[model samples]
Target: MTLPLSGLAFPPSREPSTRVPADLRKQGFGVRIAEQRDLGFMRALYETLRAEEMARVAWPEGARQSFLDSQFTLQHRHFTTQFQHAEFLVLEHRGQAVGRLYLLRESPRWLVIDIGLLPAWQGRGIGGALLRQLQRDAQGSHAQGLALHVRLDNGRAHALYVRLGFREQGGVEGLHQRMHWDVPTAVAQLNTA
Candidate 1:
């Protein structure tokens, strides 16, 4: 069931049997939970998306830092306390921070509150690789589902999410779509194989 949110389409991820690339072994980058010191790089990644105009996104350049501060709060909590979810991530390639992926867990759903790669790091397979790892990494936690809101105008992310088996859950905040992918199925398949 999906709520009647404007500009939202309820697309759910494909079944666990859905074939995602078996390129898990092809590794070129590394990732880790972000720390307080890494916020600057994270912010830079956020700024990189301003040009996306993301159709449905309305973030002003001035508020990007504060916005990230609040979003990463839970992640900070996870650093000292125990949380069943991961809300902060920093992607590195060639020893340089190039992207950020912030998540928020909601029971059966994990919301990608923020996700963007710097311009210099775009066009590579980095984004897809990150999403794949995130899905695999999230398999045993919460409800084993990965969800995110994409600026309806974020056609690139929308297409990527779809390929990763994420489907719309029909809720919107301006131009974002509530997309989710079932984690357990993915985990189970990985485990069985």
Candidate 2:
């Protein structure tokens, strides 16, 4: 598919629902969402996710493949109309897609199915900004909280979400842990940063 990596959903509002805060905004890497034809953008992003040598080595033999074959198949479908009812966002730098936030809504709770920032665009507060946007959307929908599952070995993602106020709720497959960040905590953390 064509890799149209520059379309950004500036939220359902006329302006950004909330700025990333001036201090943090300056730290913004200018990452935005990829458009409908950006499947090719995902090809490279997924490669980077799997290329984390240390994280890969820590996983059990079948861990990577199973996770990819299952969860990632859901993520890899981000560019399709299948996710039209939900929200899938991308973070771009200059003009290249650099990160993504995939969420699913099941009423009263917004499940953050996946979230990631490319290696090159990290450390710029984009992930946090995007997550806060998710937080806003969740609250506006009157959702109770946000949910996500991250493999135990994915220290990077775990740390980011935790700092964003997501706390462990349960574990699965002896690897991934389910997490949630409620509206109050989410807004507080985002504004604090």
The RMSD of every model to the true structure, in order and in angstroms, is: 11.1, 7.3
Evaluated against the true structure, the overall lDDT of model 1 is 0.60
Off by over 4 Å in 2: 1-36, 53-84, 185-193
Model 2 Cα lDDT, one tens digit per residue, 84-189: 5445555555555676666667665677766777787677666777777767667666677788888887887789899988998955656688888877856545
Q: Give the TM-score of candidate 1.
A: 0.61
Instruction: Pick the lDDT winner.
Output: 2
- Candidate 1 weakest lDDT stretch, 10 residues: 1-10
Question: TM-scores of the models, in the given order?
Answer: 0.61, 0.63
User: Over the stretch 39-87, how does candidate 1's per-residue lDDT look in tens digits?
Assistant: 5564455546754443345767446545545544433344324433444
Clashing pairs in 1: 10-168, 10-170, 11-167, 11-168, 12-167, 12-168, 13-167, 144-183, 152-175
Candidate 1 off by > 4 Å: 1-28, 54-85, 140-142, 184-193
